[model samples]
Target chain A: MEPERFRELLDAYGGEEQRWPAEHRQAMRALYTGDSGARADVQRARELDLLLDSYRVKAPDLTQRIIDRVAPTGLGRFFAWLQPTVPAQWWRPATAFALPLLLGVALGLSDGSSGASTTVIDWELQEQALLSVTNEEPWYE
Target chain B: MQRDEENELVRRITRGDRAAFAVLVGQHQRALTNYTRRMLTDTDLADDVVQETFLRLWTQAARYDAGTARLTTWLHNIAHNLCIDSFRRSSRISFSDDADSTLESDDAPDSAEHSRERSDAVRQAVASLPERQRSALILCHYQGLSNRDAAEILDVSVDALESLLARARRRLKQLLEEFHGA
Candidate 1:
């Protein structure tokens, strides 16, 4: 690999060999061993990686809170009951799952918090662009 | 969990199977939470964002296309969008608020106080980055996401993602050097 290409890969994937793209790993290893400049770049990337790793997070469990907000009713509730009892794991298709649920059920299940509404509005504003991740529009400036 | 298992769980979740939903949550909550917490630098906001992400998963389970992206990448995309929304809604981005809460792990390379101070410096430096750069770095470096997946989440090309990562690291190096120099 050329010096510039090596530096780009180093910057993008960091100094860790394991994190390097598999296809380029062999070339990168050869360059790292033969080139002092590449080694220096790797050292810088390694230091940054160590610093980045220093920042950690311990998040609280929100599983119950999220589950409680689902609140299935009527047929949905029946299915919820029947789900465990069913033996064969038949699944509906991605298209079939798009059928809209009742508005009343949506309202009924609402946690009545601003979060749901805020998120809905956010999605609504970006719905056209968000449906596809490959959209060119940036999420933020 | 494996991709097949995640797909199955998501399929069950679409049918209102709370058990599968719970299982999915148990699998991803920590990583998702860590992503949001680092993005927002606020525990409560991160929790709310995560709740909203999973809630969307529960409600919009049908929207998920396994062919498009992996389960974890999709979830991170949801949380990242929410974090951006949170950024727009509020101007209060403080690194100090959650800096102390991090780096509580028992194994430290130095004294606890010194480690925390260094950790705080890193957090502040990361927080100071432009939103895109920070997301790029956090998703790829901290979240251990592949560049392709991170680019998809950021809605950028692989080259663009690399650019963001490179800029982020360069800026972080400058910031940290300045911090130590000070």
Candidate 2:
């Protein structure tokens, strides 16, 4: 690599060879090893890296704080417990079909024409009766 | 944490599994706190932002799509947003005084006072960077995120993210050099 390109890589990736892009690592390492000027560039980058390393922050008891803040409560907790244990793949499809299944069962139970076993003939008869009522002569006449 | 394990924990968290959430908190708290601190330059504010980030994770767990990004990246994105909010709030207040108070209390260990002084200088230099550059460095250099992930968190292209990193490092080098010379 040219000197300018080498400096740009060092600035972008820092002194650490491991942090450099994998494709450029072998060439960069060879260049750094074979050239004195490249070694100086690495040294400069290393100094900056060391300076950057000093900006550490300590996290004390933060886990408990976060837990307390996000802990589920009341109805949230109850619903969480009530959540099904079924695998998502199975439960999702089942849940998707559940409403329609319930509606069909409910319609069947509410049907008075043939008790709980209403047939297509029963539905047709009910439709005919409704039409006959509408078609009757007007009471005013 | 392994990707599969984290993904499983996220699923459990969506189900309101406190234990799973706690595990995730334990796993990422340090990195998140460090990132926030670097971004905001206040330990207390960083902790607050980190706390809010986890809380958001709990409340929005169902929104997490592992197919789009890793858990760490998602967490960083949340924390980054919180940090931005905090910055806006701080901007409304007297930031100079608050920063001074925070820096005063942020003293390092007494035994290493000299190193601590150097550290403080470096910290000040970092804190002086613009918000985006600081975030770019925190995500890529400190939090060890890949360029693409950091860019995603910042809502910028990878090339833009690299430019931010380059400018940040250049400015930091200049600041450190001036500090050392002084």
Candidate 3:
């Protein structure tokens, strides 16, 4: 690695050699051992690391709090009930049988509508009246 | 946590298993919270964001494709996105008021006051960084996430992430020098 590339890697990764990319580690180590300027750059990076470590936040143990907030409740429960767990394969056959049955029921209910049946009846009556008139007026005339 | 174990827990969570959700929470809460706290510099907001992160995991568990990334990387992605949202919603970034409380209470018996001052200066410098730079620093430097993982969380290429980290460190060094000089 060039001097500038080594500096960039040190700045980006940190002073620790292990944190540096594995592929470049051998080259970086050789440069570091051979060059005084590279050593200074690593030392500066380590200083920054020390400053960062000093400000480490004590992460609060909020596991239960997070659990409570994320715990499914009220509307969550409703959605939970609606979530399908059965495999799609299981539903495929069931849906196939159910879909045709549902279509038949829907057709039957639509066929039973009073307005449609009434219209059919009116058409049949007109046909019968025409037939009677025609039969009576035929042969003698 | 083992990848297989985490994956199994997530699978159970997808099935609406609360106990499994709790286990997952226990496994990752501290790391997530610390990452947020460092990024946002506000403990309360960090906590709120962390809670929302887990809640999102619960709600969006089915969207998790373990084939692509580890669970920690995925979780950090969610947390990082939420933190960005929080920043946009409120364009204010302030240091935590409680930042020095621990320093004050320390019984280190030497230069406690000096340590507090130095620590405060460092925190201010970190907080002063741009949002992306600060996130890159927090994830890689403090949280110990790999560059690739941090880039994934930040939605940037690894090269872009390294650029951000470099700028952040350069600025931090300058700021710390100025603080000490003052």
Candidate 4:
């Protein structure tokens, strides 16, 4: 590769710290070893790339609210459900989960001490329902 | 199972199969989690984003047309949207909150001792880049994706991705020159 083009390739793929895909390595290696100027440029690019790659920052874990916010939610999904024509079957289950989720929220907000009580009730109810379902269909059976 | 399994799982999800949705979640959660962490920086936020990302996958699985892109690309698209939003929200909290991250893994390969200073300089250079260029570099270099793939994921023209990287590299070189000198 010519010097300018070689420089570009290094910019694109030369860093060890930069995650070079396996398929690109042979081509990158070939370019790196092809000529002296090219080799020097590639070496520098690799060093910079690797160095940047080393300064790792993990994006914080997303909150459930954000996820719930992004995807069509109980109300958002409900509005979609309310369209003139009847909707698909899958939507009903989503709404089933969504409506209660919304109600749970509203209920939580309204009562002065509702937040703690509601969560406990919701948890217990879910536990009993889960236990009942599991009893109905044993894993080993 | 691999692609075939993913395809099957996708089909089942389309038919409203929650179990298949769970399987797909298990398969992709790790990557999505990692991607979220890289973009958001807060472990808690990353968890929420991952959860939300999967929930999106569950809901939108029915609409996923394989012809548009691979499962991975599609997932990255969802994650990217979330990442950008989070960055926007968090931008208010930290004015200079640019990339000065610690190493996530001990197994992070050998960069020499002096490598840390160079890396910091390069990171500062990278932080000075425009968002798109910074993202392109992160996706292409740090994530180790191909130019074509990174371009597609960035939803930019290939030439645009190249130009972005070119400018980014030039600026980085300039920044490092001054840093090294000083």
Best by DockQ: 3
TM-score of the B chain in each candidate versus the native B chain? 0.93, 0.87, 0.91, 0.72
Rank candidates by TM-score, best first: 1, 3, 2, 4
Candidate 2, DockQ to 2 decimals?
A: 0.18
Report residue B156 deviation for candidate 1 (angstroms). 0.9
Ranking by DockQ: 3, 1, 2, 4
Q: How do the residues B33-67 of candidate 1 rate in per-residue lDDT, one tens digit apiece?
A: 98988898877777877877887787788999999
Check candidate 1 and list the clashing pairs. none
Q: Candidate 2: list runs displaced more than 4 Å.
A: A1-3, A77-141, B92-111, B178-182
On a 0 to 100 scale, what is the lDDT of residue B59 in model 2? 74
Candidate 4 lDDT over residue span B1-182, tens digit each? 47777888888766656567666666666667766655554556666666656666766777777777778778877777776777676663222334334434444346444455555556456656767777787677655566777788888987788788877777776777644323
lDDT of 2 by residue, B89-170 (tens): 6763222234423332344477356555666778788888888998888888888887778999999997788789889999
Error of 1 at A11 (Å): 2.0
* Interface C-alpha RMSD, model 4: 7.0
Alpha-carbon TM-score of each model against the true structure: 0.75, 0.71, 0.74, 0.61
Model 4 lDDT at residue B22: 64
Instruction: Give me the displacement of residue A7 in model 4, in angstroms.
Output: 1.5
Ranking by lDDT: 3, 1, 2, 4
Q: Enumerate the candidates' DockQ scores in order.
A: 0.21, 0.18, 0.23, 0.15
